[model samples]
Structure formats: C-alpha cells, structure tokens
Target: MSTRLGWTAALMLSALSLVPARAQDAPKTWDVPMGGNSYLTATSADAAKRGGRNDRWNSPDNVTSVYFRVDRAAELNIALRAKVPQGESRIRATLAGKAVEKDLKGAETADVPLGKVVMKAPGYVKVDLQGLKKTGEVFADIEALEVTPTGKDAAAVVLNYVKDNKDNNFYWGRRGPSIHLGYELPKGEPTEWFYNEVTVPVGSDPVGSYFMSNGFGEGYFGMQVNGENERRVLFSVWSPFKTDRPGEIPEDQKITLLKKGEGVHGGEFGGEGSGGQSYWLYPWKAGNTYRFLNRVHPDGKGSTVYTAWFFVPEKNNWQLIASFKRPKTDKHLTGAHSFLENFADRQGYLSRGALYGNQWSCDVKGEWHESTVARFTTDPIGRSLFRMDYAGGAKGQQFFMRNGGFFAENVKPDQKFTRESTPAKKPVIDFKKLEGADLGS
Candidate 1:
C-alpha cells in the first residue's frame, strides 16, 4: 500500500504573546480570474491519455503558438504547461525573420519549459516548439502562456514534470512564495504521478507554501525548480497509510512533531547568487503513508533542512515516541542529496546526514523498493523535513510519512506551552469554514 501528502516548511522565531492570533483564523475565499486572451487559451480538442494516440504531441497545436505582433524589439517568455507525455521536443522561438532554439529533454511527458522567443526590431516574431529525440518517448502539454521583458539575457527557464491539470479546484492566492499552488485530485482517472511547477517572478523572497494531497492510500510525488544552481537543492517526503486533506486530519491519527532546523543564507544553505533561506520540519499522524515533494525558489540561492516537532495530544511538550518506524529503502540515486526522517516524541527532525547519488531509497520491510524520482536545484536556500508515525525505526523500518520544507526560514517555533499546564489544544484549520477569507489578489 502507498500514501501521499503535500506540505510546506517555514521558519519564524518570535511571536506576539497575548497578541491577536491572525494567521490561525481561516483561509479567505477568493475568486480566480479567467485567463482568456489571444496570447493564451486552453486547447481541449485532440485530447489524449497516457499511452493513447496523440499523447506524443507536446500540446494541441492550437495552444502552442502565441499570436502577437512585435511593436519594437523585446524578449518574451513562452510558458508551457504540459502533463508528463511520452517524448521530448526541442523548444524554439522565431520572429518573421529571426529564430532561436533549445533542446527540451526528459523521460515522461509532464516537463514544463518556459521557452523564450526574442523579437528584434520592427519584425513579427513566432516562437517554435519541438522536442529532442531520446531513448524513451516524452512529450509536454501546453497550458498557460506568458511573455516577459528580458534585458539582453533572453533565456527562458524550461520546467519539467508539471502536475497542473484541468478539473482541479485552483484559485489565485498570493504573489511570490506566499502564493499557494495546488490542485484537487481528479475523481475519474487514477493519477499515475502528479507533478507541480511554479515560477517566482525573476527576483523575489519566498517565505513558504503548503502541499496537501488529502486522499486515501499513498500518492507518490515530488517538486523541483530551475534557476541559479539548478541541481544542488533537494526536498522530498512520503505518506505511509492514508487520510483526507489537511483540513480533515483525523483526531486519532494526529501524530506528534519531531525536529526543526533553519538553513541560513551564508554557508551550505545559501549558494552563488544573493543569499536565500532553508528550513526542515515534519508533521505526521500514526499509521499513514504520504506523498513527499521537493521544490526550489525561482530566484533564491541555497537549500537546507528545517525544524521538526511531533503533534502530541493535550500536552504541548515535544517528546519522542517509539511507536513509529523510520524511513528505509534500497533504491538510491547519483548526484543528489537525500535525508532520513523520524520523530522524537512530538518533535520532527531529519538526521544531519544526507546521501548524494543517482539513486537512493528509504529502507523498508527489510527489502528495497524502487522509487519514482525527480531532480532539484543546487543553490538551495531552506531545509527538508521528514515525518512518520508507524511501528519501527532505523534498520528494519516502514515509512509512514515524509514531507519537504522550503523557504521556511521565516516561521518561528510553536509558541512555548503556557506555564500553566493546560491540555494541548488541537490546531484548528478548516477549509470549509475559511471559505469566507479573501483569496483573490
């Protein structure tokens, strides 16, 4: 059996005691605007499924081209949203008289690439798109289109393995990192592998966001971003049993917090460009397998693991429990950094050590299971956290939950338990009740 979940990691130091508790209210409801324009439109015809006909095509030709006349001379960003298809295509851009092209390579079909078509002086520009040939078939589905002003540097960031699809209850929330990017699992089709992608404007300080896949059974997933140091940063998580969305976490399944840490801007946390943030924390309930993900900032430089704490009932003190199993696997990867997750009473913490390889795994059932995987950025700012409440630890283990935290160096630890021993209050968050909160930009 497999389980999947999505979450975020943030780091904050201080809080207003006796202060107005605003963040805990509820998410406000917001209306998402319809993106209808000549520049972008949804292509619903010529639809195909995985291993179905027309599945190899990146996107219906109808939505692939942006129809715009060049006024003077400017660089435009061509954003393509495609679920994992079957093959790769070389992405190209061209004007009435000029053209630029790049190879967009991948294994499955959901790789999203922000291809750029530069229009120089007085002529019309048309960006062309195609995939490169590889050992396996691969394709990308085109969704939204965006054009941005690129100063001299006109390279578009190509994103791969996207999870945005139709039928999802999506809405526009905040800008930058506070922005919430999510999707509701489709009811009819069984999702093979879900992917998600977000581009934080060129330069922005990202706080952190949440990834919640509240569904029964385990849903395998991951997150990645391309920017300064694309291959250095890494984040991942998993769910052992099953449950509903974050708003529906069961009372009996609420697990304790484990450990928490912050990866600051200078050392391994921050890389090349301007310093960034890194965080690690894990939240879990007993006997559940959750999907794990890893994401990178569109503009930050660095990555690190964050703080962790287990969710204890009534009593607020973070203590260690021996009822859950640690993550284990025989699968491994090359050139990537990895972590092992567990709980110390109520505190969630990832061991200080991580492995680098082309393949990696969390030991489980005294045997190794091959894992579905993805890659991450190098200059990662923030940390990765893992959580689980199962039946064993280390050596022979079973994974109950694994989560990743990014740009979370801003969230402070939970306020210290009140001196007066009050029963541990359950954290209250209800999406149905928060429907009145404003979510529109």
Candidate 2:
C-alpha cells in the first residue's frame, strides 16, 4: 500500500481530541454508589404514585451535592440524566436555596436543553432527597452534571489536526442569527475516519441552518432538524464525477453540496431538540464547486456524535461544518419557505427514501444515497475518497483520526451528434423557379 493508504487505515480506530475542561469551570460531581440486585422489575405508574413504591425506584446515593464558587454573576447551562422506572419519578434541582422539579423517561435522551434546570446565582445546587416509589426494585442511574459558559462572546472551539499538521484553527461565528464556519484540508489527508464530536455551550436554541460538505465520494451523513422554527439542516458528502465507477474521479475534485435534509425532513417542530446519525452521498454535478453547508447545529454539545469511513480512492482531502442557534422569543427564519410541507423530489437526481416510527424519514440510505449521473475513476492515485464513522453510545465523547486523505476526480461528458442517414436533393432550385414570379404579375 502507498503512504496515503497506510495513513487512511490508521485513523479509523482512535478517538478525537477534546477541549480541556477548565480547572475553575469543572463542576463538582459525585457518583451515587447505590449497589444491589434490582429490587423491582418494570411496572407502569404515574409520577407521584411511582415515587410511592420503594421497589420501583432507587438512587445511586441517598443524596448527591454540587457546590460552585463563582466570583461574579454568570449564565450557565447544566445537564443531568438518570435511569428511572417506566412511571414518572419526582426529581429536583435546588439552587442557592430554591428547588425545581424535573421528569425523566427512558425514551428521552439526555440533552442540555431537555430536562434543563437553570440557576442565576452562585452557590450549591443540590438534588434533594428522592420521593421515588414503585412496585419492584429497579436502578435509577444518575448520570453526570456539566456546566459551561453561555453568551455572545462564548464560542464553540474546533481544532482540526489532519495527518501531522495541527494549528488548523476552525472558527464559527454567529452573525445576528446565521452561522459561518469552514476549514482547509491538509496536504497529507486521510481516509476512513470519524468526526468524534463538536462541543457547544448550553442555553443555545436548536440550530436551523445546518450544512456541511467535503469534495469526495459520499460518506454516511446525518442531520437532526428538531425544534419550533421548523428549519431544514443539511449535512452531506460531495464530489465531481464522469462515469459509473467509484474511483473514476481524480484527486482534484472540488467540494460541493452533497446530501441535504431540507425543512423538517424527520421530526416535528417544537421547543424540544434531538440528535442521531445516518449516511450521505453527493449528487454528481458538471461544474466543480468546493464548499457545502450543514444547515443545522449538532443538538448542543452532548447530543450529536458521528462515525464514518471512506475508501482511499486515488486522492485524499476534506473538511467539516458544525453550528448552533439559541431559542428565539420571536418569529424564526423570515422569508424562508416551509420545506417540509411542500417538498418535491429534485429532478435529474437519483432519489430514495424511508420513514421510521412517526417523525423520522431515513432516506439517506434506502433511497437517496445515489446520483443519477453515473461517474467513476480508474486511476492509481495515491489518496482516497473521504470516509466517516459514527457511534452515539456515549454523550460528550471525542474521536481521534489516525490517518486519512481526500479523493477527487475530473469527469465530464462530451457532446456527440449524428447525421441524417439519407441525403436530400437540390429541391430549393425548383421552388425558386415556380411561384414568386407569377405573384408579381
């Protein structure tokens, strides 16, 4: 294998780098050490009655405490999760001296905004003693608590380290209500890699404009367009091609818009947000255009994570896009059409689709992963097309890319014309001699 091929295999297994937790900002967390066989199995009950049965509910610790010493007033976002029985359990967040209740169901993933309990002052925020009860004994697992800064100046930081080059500073900016971010592929790129995770501060609303793209064959891409604005977010892989074969494209293919999830392609629009992963492909286009959009934000810091892999074609190169938006007290994205209600299949593109449960449409694979225009390459180029791998088992996790490269190709079709089979005689000479002279007389 070539050096580029060797590096592509290396980036597949490792985790990515993560922003270090600040010494001062790390919140004090204590795990509840409750241990024993489950006292109760599954049962159905309401919120207050479920707290009545001892067998149905239990806490890691009888009590868990978290203290803070903020020098000044600061806005912070906090996240908490627990494994409780089917019925509702009474949970509380006591800040300074007041308490607020929260409800946890197994189906709802732990998102910063989901079961959020906010505090405005500095002091200890404690989860009070439980009033949980149920028929049988079950484990109420207490997850971790995370607190981070939130403000106009508070930005999500991303550092891309491709091959051996680091210092690729990727900056995302919030302009009024829109976001802008991009990066340059390193000279020595890698294939078969994953995007570990991107962290964002809490208190941010679900993002509306989600878009991302890289110049290569499509990889597995995902888009989570939840929340009330009902805006569409797009995340896709892209390339330029001329034939039906996969490796037909060369290393110089330009990045363009690949797969896209317009309007509310999956779930409903509400104040709530969700996250998940899926696959993607870039439709073949004649012109080479680098740069695409992932129109939505990763569902906050802990909600979105992905893993993808690309075959190292003959070339290797790529970049990433991530974003977020805060909740709006007013009307959302103005002048934008409702993409969900009036979606039409784009002409001249190969399309497939799927719908799961009630709200999600899994069209990225079963249907929408291919392009109508057939293009491929057959070159021994050193680099490979992009690859992506994703797993969301653990929230707030990171990834490390070992080795990779971007694949690009140039393939455009040439126009061809056919001549008529039979030749025409000189009929024009007879027409000129026949009628025009008589009309003048």
Candidate 3:
C-alpha cells in the first residue's frame, strides 16, 4: 500500500510541473492619446484608469480609433476598460484589421477582452471602438486600452513596442531618430556641472533654433542659435519668490551681469511667476565648432549660483557669459538635454540639422563621468499640431537631430567618443584682464 501511494504522489507532482508558470512581472501600460489628430475622438473627461484621464464617444455615429506602431511581430492581448450605461449594447472592436464583437448589459464598468491578433511586423495596430446599440442617452466611457503581451516572445514584443513608439510630440507620423546618446542621472541624484562640444558644418542651414540646456526650471544654463543667424549663450536662476517682468524680479532673484560679449543684451524674459533673465544677441558664425560648459554651485549663505561659459576655436580660450544667484536653495543640476528644432512659421516642411557629441558631467563631489546612451523624444506641439517631419540618427561618430529644410542623408549620430581617463583641464582665462576689456563690441 505504501509503495502504491508513493507512485501516485510522484505522478501528481510531474503533472503539476508540466503546467506553465504565470509571468510574475507587472505588464507595461501605454496611455492612448484621445484628443490628437491621429486619435479620432468626440470628447474627453477626467475618468482615466491608467494615466490620469480618459475620453468618451456618444452614440453609434460617433466612433473613435487609435493607431499605434510596434517594432516586432507578436500576439497582443488587447482589452478595453470601459463603463457601459443603459441597456444591452453591442461594442465592436478591431485589431490590426481583425474584428470582434461583445455585448454589454446593465450599468457597471468592466474590462472587455477584444480577442488576440498577431502583429506580423513593425507597423501600426489600429483599434476602432463603436457602439451598435444604445438604449439610454450615454453610450460608453473609455478608461484606456489595456494591451498585454502573451506567448514565448512576450518580453521582446513589449520592449520593441516601447522602443518603436515613444511620446515624441515633434515628429508626427514618422519614425524616431535612428540614434541618440542620453545620460540621465539616477532619480534624485543631481550633478553640478555639464560640458559638451557641438560642431555645425560650415554653411549649415538651421531651420529655426537649437538648444543645449543643463539643469531645469529652478536654475539652468546653455546656448541657442536661432535660424542660423541669431546666436547667444544664456544663463538664468529662478527667484525664491514668483513674479514675471524684470522690474518685479527681486535682487536675490537676479544674476548681476558681470561681463557680456559685444551686442549682448541682459534683461528679464518669460511670463507669469516662472520668469528668468536673458542675456543674448551675441555674434556666432556658422561652420564653427564650439564648446559649452555650465556650473551650478551654492553660495555660502542661502542661494545658488549658475554660470555659463563658451569657447570658440578662434578665441582659443573660455569666456564667461553670465552668472545668477538663486536665493535659499541647495540643489544640484537636473534635466540635461540637447535638441535641434525649427521654430519657423512654415513648420517641418523645411529641414535643419546639427551635430552634438563629447558630453560629460561632474557631480557635486567633483567626480567626472562620460555619458553614452541617450533616449530620443520630440516636441509635442510641433508633431501633433504642425505635422512636421523630424529625423534623428547616428552617422560615423556623431549624433544629429534635423527638421524643417533639407538635410543630407549621410548626416547621422554614429560618432565614436573616447572616454578620458583624467579630469578635464580647465581653460586659461584671465578674469582680471577680461573684467575691464571692451567685450560688448
């Protein structure tokens, strides 16, 4: 009897082992944009299941659909988390051209599974939702579409989907930039300085404006070249208090203009309580390679100082742009990024491009490190509203972002960067000699 029981227990254990284990990781959720041009929508509300808000469409005539792109072929478990109001109603859903129908009765909210479909390649997943029958005035409230991956390649499928589809608002109806290098500091770990080199090929036509900014809203420094004509290096610090114009900006909120290049103007800019000072209109030439350096350090008392410096190969040295002090704060730098954009009225019908590389950062402890991998994103206003064509890619050893106007096909972000073993050498600049010298030419 004991031998027979052991045999039966062994058989049961083997059968249990044959059953597959459920995926332990939480599924990634993507928020569907309902108001944009690509997403055909009737109305939006504060009811959201995933993000913060959702949309609603009334009646059968008002139908809505969303088109999403993916990079791999895999099976997707798509479902709609929605609330059905009124009597029994028919809800039709389509995934990648395949259609399914479901009937909802009563007035409760539920997740309606919309059948699985195989995405054969890197392409769009078109989901359409409409009500076939509505007994009451209200039809449905769509919280969001819950898309879960199923099968052996589920992990790869989710990764490919995220990589192919980013919330890039600047490049509408187009693939993302081929390559980008971003060094995002670990959350809550801020740095004190950033340094990088940018090269604009001779006679490079910039569409509108390009910016390289380090730090964020509280304090920031960087440079901007507008329309390949206007060039300026900018630095600003937020005031402890909030207000707009220069006159109302407190003295502690202001960065004294110590020195500036010829034709540079220093004053306040921006709107509302979130304003900062601007020192711009400096002369910058095309086809010239330049170095940008920024520093954010705290003052002894209760303020922080933000400074910017620029180096032109012609000058062979670093020159200070400006420095501002922010009152009562001990914070390091945050949100470092570089972008190429066309602020022209014609939008992305034209093209402009530039090359940026050799990005490095220094922590508050004075340790230096080089940044390698970067995630690519775009301007939301330009992509959805203007419908422009923005392209980013790597070529050789350089990475570039281009939009508006014409760009050469070979321009890409393939530049190779060599890590420096030693700390960066400071440039030789005599502040004493520059203090009185006529810089504002």
Candidate 4:
C-alpha cells in the first residue's frame, strides 16, 4: 500500500479508541443531606447544636462527621455545601485516612471542594469535617456533603442515605434502626404471665435506649435511660380506642388504672399512641441482670387487666410497677416479643445493646415453659434501606441485639435462633402472695 493509504488506516484505528472513552457514562454526583445523616463527634458532642437541631453542623470545637453507604468500592470526589456569614474560614475534610483543607468566604452557601477519597470496599463511609480556623462567629453552616464519583469503577457506585425530607424521614433516619426478637411461645397453652431477664453491658447502655424485656399484644414493660441522671422502669398499656391523642380516646375504651405501687407514677400518655403509662424512677445499674414479670388475664367482665412487676437485683426484691384494666378487651397475651429502640434522635449516633435471656411463660394452670426459639426482626426504618445498623441473634444461651452507631454489620429480618434452654433455672414464685394485693375499690 502507498504512504497515503497507510496514514488513513492509522487514523481510523486511533478514532475507534477515542469513541469508547467519549461514550463512557458520566458518574452521578450525590448530595447527602446533613440533617439526618450527620453526628456531632466532639469532646462535648452537643456543642454543635448552637445553630439548630441535627441539621446544621456549625461548631468549631470538634469534628462533624457525615456517613453514607456504597454498594462497591469507589474513588469519591467529596465537597462540602457550606457558607461563612462573614470573613474567611479554614476547614479540613478527612476520609479514608486522607485529609484535605480548604478556605471559604462566600455570602451565600456553595459547594466547596475538599478533595478526593478512596473507599477500599463496599460499606459505610465516614467523612470528618473539622474547622482549622475561622474569622466568623462559627466555622461554617455545613448543610450537606456533595460526593461526585469518578474513574472507571465510579459508574458502579451507589450511595445510600436519608435522601430527602419527605414523611419526616430526617427525624426517623437520625434515630437509626430499631430491632426486635419475636418469642415462640408454646402453641397449646395460654400465656397468663411472661417472665424474662435483661442485662445491659457496661458502656453499651446509652441515653434514650429502651431495653424492652417483655411485650404483649396490648402493652410493653421495659427500662430506659431517660436522661443523664434518670433511669426508669416503664410499663404502658394502650387504649383499645385506637387514637394518637389520648384526649380523643372514648372513656369507655380508655385504659383504666387499677392499682399502683408506692413511688410509682401512673398517668395517660400520647404521641406514639394513647395509653396508660406507669413508671418508677430507679437507680438501675448496668452489667447486672434485671428480671421482669408481666401478668395478663381477662377479668370475665369483658376487660383485660395487665400487671407488671420488676425485680431489682440490687435490692433483691420485686417491686410492683403498676396495673391497668383495658376496656373492650378479653384476651390473653398473644404477641410475645422484645425490642431495642432509640427514642432520642440526637442520641442515634451512639451504639447501645442489650441481652435477653432465660425467658419463661406461665399458663392458667400455673405451669412454666421455657422459650428457646426466637426470630430476629427490625422496624420500618431498617427495611426502608436508609438506616441498616441493627443486629440480633442468639449468642450461646441468650439473644443479644445491637443498633445505631452506623455499624456495617446488619442481621437480616426473619432470622431464627435457638438458645440453649436452662430448664433448671425455672423461676419459683408464691402465687398467693402476689394475688393477695388489696386492689382497692
């Protein structure tokens, strides 16, 4: 072939190579909101709240972290959506063992590039933003983290997080995921009483955590970390009227207070549901096993009565929490389960866990049966694919559950577990003594 023909053939080969590069799909840029996707990881974490609720991270005291998930390993180009009210501010973004510093000074918020990060594997990734220096009142009102993936593997990346504000998801997403264990009661017998024990490990008990030990069809009996200085054993029974507002519940279908022990506070509660709530402020310590006993039975007057008593191991005595009679209900305990939940949205960044073991249920004939099998499950938050930090299963002879803290390990729902039964440890109770309480008129 001539020199002209050879040059034309070389050009055709080079053009073919360029076509593939130009046709490659552009990687998408994900704008992850900070309202429901960030945590204040500082010396005094709540110090970041000067601006607003969990939505704004404006503190210069410590690192403000944002978390999200990816399906595959990615080389992420990350930026911060922030603005300085006045003057310039210096900030640092750290991710995957790399840190990038940038200075910003803008009247309005804008996407400020912090540089690139490479996630080695698929899972949750944490990006820590710290204020190096600032000339304004605060470092910057960091609204969201803008992630733009590039490179050959970038097109395979999919980020998962609380994407929007619809349906109050920012509130629920920040609260993390709630997990539960469904107990398998004996099929042939009636559950007149449910007995279970809960032990929260030291350092695993955080504020706003509820370790529900016993749950029935109408109510639940559990203990919670209400505040830094307060802990309570709580029992509540729902009104059959089915309303979110307690004032709207018809008097006939309302839950009536039957009796309460000394120092126990009993009243009506609403928001989650209308119910009669009872609680006793007790100095419950962690790493100690606490026992819960719940009694449910029909009063023959077409109403069901629920009574709860919690054993204080420190005092070695079972104190009555309260008792309530539910109108228009004449059934025994049916749905037997225990759940772990975080009620405070701000506390969702911390990890908490509890152990449920030695479960037993008594029938009308006064025979106790052991519960060795259970199924692990999660709430809608877990299934929504937004928050997946939850786990539960049998570890030796007890079932343990862990949630929050943005952990990567997640236990799938409907997973069954069987713990070794401790039949020799059956509870011995004096039925006559418990029944002799003077439930006054």
Candidate 5:
C-alpha cells in the first residue's frame, strides 16, 4: 500500500474484505454524522446550531438536510441515529420525494431504520429530515444518518462523506472546498499592478459565494454575496506581525490605513489571520462584467502600500475601494491567484461559479504582461480528499471555477490550464484618472 494513502483509504481497504479501493471510499456502511454534515437550511443561523453535537433539531419547522455521495447505484437502507426523551416524536425523511416516516420513542440512542431506496445513478444525494410531531421536551437528539447497501450489487458500492472529525474537518468539511487559479507570471518581473475581470453568470451567483478576482502573496480582493439583500466588494491585507488576534499586533507591525474611498469601511479583521480589512456594499449584478485592479509598491522605507480599485460597467468609471500600508514589508506583488469559496457554511449546499478573464500585470518598468495561463489548485479541504466538489479550467478565453455544491467529477487539482489569450481585449485603464478620483485628505 502507498504510504501516502489516507487513513480513510486504509479503513476502506480493511473493511472491503481485503479488496483495495480509492481514498475516502467507504466499502461498508457510511455513517455520516448529522452534527457534521447536516444543516438546518430553513431556520435562522441561531436556530441552525440546534443541529449541532450537543443539541439537535426539536422544532418541527427546522428543515434539516444531510448530504453524501455514492460512486455507483445502490439499494441503500437508510437509518437515523437518534433518541427522544419522554414522549414519542415523529420524523419524515425524504429523498427525491420518496418519503419515509419513523417514530422515535426511545430514550436511548438507536439506529431507527427508515426503509430503503434504489439509487439508479452515481452522484451526490441529499436527505431531508423534518420533524412532524413530538410530545417530548424536544423532537429528538439526532446524531447521524447511516446508509447501508443491501442489494446483491452492494459489494461494488463506494460512499464518500466526512469520514471522521480529524483535523477539525467537521467544520471545514461542511463548507466544502475552496478552489483557486494561480496565474502564471513571467519570471524576474516585479508586478506593480494586477488587473483582472470577473463575471458571474446569472444563475451562478449564490449567497455566501466569494468571487475573488485578484489575489497576491499577502492578501485577496473579491466580491461576495453576503445575503439576498446585500453584496460587497471586499479587500484585506495580512499584517506582517503574524498573529490571529488583531489586537496583539505591535505598533510598528500594525497595518496603517493610508487612504480609503467614500462609502468604504476600513477596520481590523481577525480569526484566520489578523489583518486590515475594507469593504463597500456595492450591489454588483450578475452577467455584468466587473473589473478589479490592485497596485503593490514598496514605499522605499521598509513598507508596502496596497491600493485596490473596482470598476462598474454601469457607471463606466472606477471607484477606489481602499488603501493600506503594511509595515515591515518591502516587495512587489507576487504569487498572483484567484479563488472561488463559500464563506457561509449554512449555504454550502448551493452551487456557485465565477468567470475570470483579461489577466494583465504591469511590471515596474511599466510593461503590460498578458497572463494567459494558470495552475489549478485548491485549499487543504480538497487536497485532503475530504471534499471533491471543486472544479476549475479554461472556458473560452476566461478561466472558471465552481465549488461548494458537492457536484461530482471535479477537476484534478494542480493541473495547469492555459486560456486562449485575447490580446485585443486588454484593458485600457486611466491610471492617472484613478489616482485623481477621491484621494483621501
């Protein structure tokens, strides 16, 4: 066996009657924990946590859903691991409108079988569980959704899910994979400016989706669907201080706010990595191409200033988003990339995509370098094989990436893709005009 094989692979091999299979393949029954892979999509964010480890769905209104994948057709016998204290409760489980109702009256956890169904194809499956009626303190303390193949052809079935809670993957796995496109840049060329355009197809724009256009070594610039009523153009830069807590940054290492455009809010953001964050609530629409431009230049005094601008086609003008100077750093933009990610885990079940095109980087010598090639990659979630729902490649002259929907047949990671360059479609930007627009006092 290859030492590079994951623990899930080893487990699958051991359970497959000594027959080998691919990574994250479940030859036996797949026990997908409800706390890890389930979400209450119809409830508020506060009510959704009721489906967590300690507590579970009690309200009949909370529409809880769990998801997984099967590599082949299977006669799947579905069951739920749960317990109801006091009186009895009812749960209606539905898959493709084939509904099964189960009564939960036991105070102790047990595998309550919800009958069987024949999946005629290979793909992701979503099981919806809803509370019908209950006479107890809560509907039930549900834990996991177990699926066992019982048909004669079950021996060839392969299942995929969040196999275990290792590496705190339960939280990370729920949100799915974050996919990227690394733009290939010329060697030895210092990039002072990076310009890229992104267009979200009409139906591809989903809530919680971040369509990142320009990503450098230090930070990323993107637009995100915050909610049904809110969207934003966001930009952030990590502090060289290297701390997860923004307050811990030293005075000299703190990100200095140089300037910001009107309607843009600038503040310190923490959690992933402490950094200065800025955003503007701009209602950018789908199907309309938006332009992103970023400039990275050293201040000659051991600091680098980053300025971002957004161009809206409706206005036919560019708006300076924000600018910040990071201390203890002196370098031009390096490692240019773009990514598509789902920021809200509750909305992870929804599909989203973004089209990135017209990548051009201006060197310090003021030469415009056309970037027609990019390397496809993903975050650790995809690399770990924990989630394989991300895809990226060249579509026409633009590069596109889709993630978070659990669609099958993902693009292989770490593959290089080259888009046909449209040299005539290169951006004709007025740098001087951008410099003159709303300079902060």
Candidate 6:
C-alpha cells in the first residue's frame, strides 16, 4: 500500500478506537457539562428534584430554543423532564423540523416524551419550544433533555459520522466561528505562565484574523496574525474592562508597552477588553513556524503583570512584545485557546488552517506541565447561521485546526520544538537592510 494510504488507515483505526463500546447502550445526556453551547438566552439552571441542576425557567417571550449535536442517524427517544405551570400550557416542540405538541397541566414535574425523533444526519438537533397559548409568567421549567439512542452500533455510527462530516466550509455553515482547541485549567490550579509554538498556514481568505490566546474573556495575553491587505503580527493584552479606547482604559486595567522592535506599532485598539496592542508590519510567510510565550505573575505592587514574547526562527532570539498590568485581580491563568476565523463579510468564503503544539503551562508553584488535550467547540455564529466547514485533530504530536472550504482535510500536527532550539538561526528580515527601506501603502 502507498505510504499515504497506510497513514489514512491508521488514523481511521485510531479514531474508531477512541469510542467506548458502552456508548451503544449509554444514552446521551445534556446538562451543564455541555458548556455554553448547550443553552441560549433566558435559559437558566434550576434545582432538580433528583439531584444536579436542571436547565429550566424558559419563558415564551424569550428562551425559545435549545441546540445539541447528534453523531448519526438514529431513532432517538426525545424526552423532556419539565414542570408545566398552573393552568393548561401548550408546548410545541420541534426537532430537526419534526414538530410535536403536548398539552400540560399543573405544577408537578414529570418526564414528558416528545416522541421519537429520527436524526437523519450528523449535525445539530435544534429543539424549538413554542407556547401556543400565552398565559402565566413561564410555560414550564425544563429539567433535562434525555436522548437515548435506540439504533444499532451507536458507538461505531457516531465515530463514522464524525469522520464523514469533519471537513467544513470556510465562509458558510460549518466554519465561520473561530474553532477553539485548548485546555481549561482546573479550579484552584491557576496557571502562572503559558506558551505555544504555531506555524501560520496560508489562508484562502485574506480578510480574516487568527488568534492564539492564553486566557479568556476580560483578561488575556497572546498573538494574532491579521490577514488584511497588509499582513501584520499583532501582540496584545486585554484588561478586565469594556473601554472604548486604550487611553480611556483605567490605569489599573491598562497594559503598558515597555519596548518594541523596529517598525512595530504600539497603542490601543477599540473593541472587547480594550487594552494595549502592538503590531509589526512583517509579511510573515506561510508554513513558517513561530513561537509565542506569555508569563503572568504578580508585579511588586499589588497588581498582576502579563508579559508577551515572540521568537522569530530567523532571528533565533526572543523579542519582547508587551507587558500589561491587571489590577485588583491576582488570579492565575484560566482559559487557554486558539482559533482561526474570518472577520470579513458573510459572503467571504476564505479559509485558513494552523498547527499548534508544544503548549506548556506553569502553575503558581513554578512547576510546568505540557498540555496534550483540549475540548473542541464552535461559536454561536458558526453553529447557527454559517454551517461553515471546520475540523481539528492531532497531526502526529502537534494538534491542528482547519476550517473553511468543503474539501479541506485535517492536517497532521507533526511540527516539533524545544527550549534548546532557540538562538540557532537569524530571522528572514535583515534589520540593517530594511533600515532605510520604506514599506508603504
């Protein structure tokens, strides 16, 4: 057999082996563990009678629907554990375009089967709840959703289904949201530092932005390769505030630029978590590997400091990106993630792929650990509107994320790196030669 065919077969076998044999009999349960993707607006958690919290308190005006993914076509027993409010309440539940209605009464909670839903394919199962009669504050309190598979070879079916739908388009449907792959630190084990090596891949779309972030939401530190008309390497830090401009950001939540390289711009950009952003107009070529490092530790003064660094292979040295101070919080690093997405128009069908690996994180005690696992997830826009194509998997030791275009296949994360590999080579740019060069628009 050809070498490529041999590798393909091996990968298929490995993927299938990851599925537990008991999954055939085990029913898929949706709860809090499913993360933010499971619930929508107005859907809050309520105490369940049996134990654990039930996703409930959905009203007619708001909480209209819920979404979940199914691996294959199967006979799924769709049932809802809920309590109907006082007076007769009509709930019209639809799954995969199939609709069913139940006329419920009283305040007692019970498991109401919404009948069998035939999942025709491997995709999201959107359950829309509509109250036919407008009465009372809420229609019902949804306790849980039980999806028990009644088909044969459930485990095998799910694995095969994923393999078939793994590739997603860049612009529409499956790949629009930044596909994230990273580890969320366990509670109490906050990360003091984190770093990763990534090779920026060429993208079909030149308008999107690729982000490698070490921390989530209000506070984060990382690098971005903006693929606008002029390609640039952007290193930034976000404070825990929602300010319009960087200067307007409070001192306590500001990220100060201590130093920068030639041609690098330092300032604040508007948007979420406004803080400090440093950009260098370097036309980073595709397929070249780059290393990003971030250290989060407490500054002498009561605040925390986030420092970013980039290692250019050609320069064989690490360059300082920026340092930002986050006041009032001395917490450790929380979320570590990377994503490839487009920020251009919806019709923009551009696609991109990137390899990320050698991810290391240090705890407050100064111990370091290599992260090897991550939970894959999509954004709301990608999950709902754009069925964009996207997929992530290990390419050897490295893990890669690819999205956009229907034919895009998974790339092997075989790129390797080490601490001793630095200071070995100079960067592609000749600082002396570019000294008098004007890279203009």
Which candidate number maximizes TM-score? 4
Candidate 2 lDDT over residue span 131-210, tens digit each: 34432243334433444445542233111112221121000000011111111112221221112112212222232212
Give the higher-lDDT candidate: 2 or 4. 4
Residue pairs in steric clash, candidate 5?
A: none
Q: Where does the lowest 10-residue lDDT sum fall in candidate 2? A: 168-177
Q: Which has the higher TM-score value, candidate number 2 or candidate number 4?
A: 4
For model 4, residues 1-441, the per-residue Cα lDDT tens digits are 111100112211222222223344567777777766876666334643352233233445666678898767778888776667777888888886688889989867667887887877777888987878877766776667778888987776888887765677777888888899999999877888899999999998888899999999898999999988899999999999878899999879989998887899999999888989999999888898999998888888889889999887766777889989998999888888999999987678789999999999999888999999999999877888788788899988899999998877778888999999998889998755663133421
User: How many residue pairs in model 3 have overlapping backbones?
Assistant: 28
TM value for model 5:
0.88
| Per-model TM against the reference | 0.20, 0.21, 0.48, 0.89, 0.88, 0.50
Sliding window of 10 residues with minimal summed lDDT for model 5:
1-10
Give the winner by lDDT: 4
lDDT by candidate, in order shown: 0.24, 0.24, 0.51, 0.80, 0.80, 0.53
Q: Which parts of model 5 are misplaced by more than 4 Å?
A: 1-27, 43-56, 151-156, 436-441
Candidate 5 per-residue C-alpha lDDT over 1-441 given as tens digits, one digit per residue, 9 for 90 to 100? 111101122222222232235355443677776544666557546554543221345666667777888878878888876667679998898975689888889876667888777778777778888889988767776667778887677777887777665666666777778999999887766888899999999988887899999999999999999888899999999999888899999998998888888899999999889989999999999998899999998888889889999986777888888888888898999989999998776667778998999999998887898999999999987887767788999988999999877787778899999999989987787677885233221
Q: List the lowest-lDDT window of 10 residues for candidate 6.
A: 1-10
Preferred candidate (lDDT higher): 3 or 4: 4
lDDT tens readout by residue for model 3, 302-355:
666666667756666666666655666766676666665443332222345567
For residues 1-441, what per-residue lDDT tens digits would candidate 6 score against the true structure?
111100112222222232345454465433311112222323223422222222333344333444455556766676765666656678888776788889776676556788777766665565666666635655665544546666565545331111221232212232245677756454456676677777766653344555564544334444444544466667666656677666677766666655566667888777544777777666666677776666666665666666666667778766665555566656556677666665542222345677776677767665666676666666654454333356776666677776644322332232322222222231232222322111110
Off by over 4 Å in 4: 1-24, 43-59, 435-441
- Evaluated against the true structure, the overall lDDT of model 6 is 0.53
Runs of candidate 3 exceeding 4 Å displacement: 1-182, 186-190, 202-204, 213-230, 238-263, 271-274, 280-282, 346-348, 382-388, 405-441
Which segments of model 6 are wrong by more than 4 Å? 1-175, 184-190, 202-205, 211-229, 243-252, 406-441
lDDT of model number 2: 0.24
TM-score of 3: 0.48
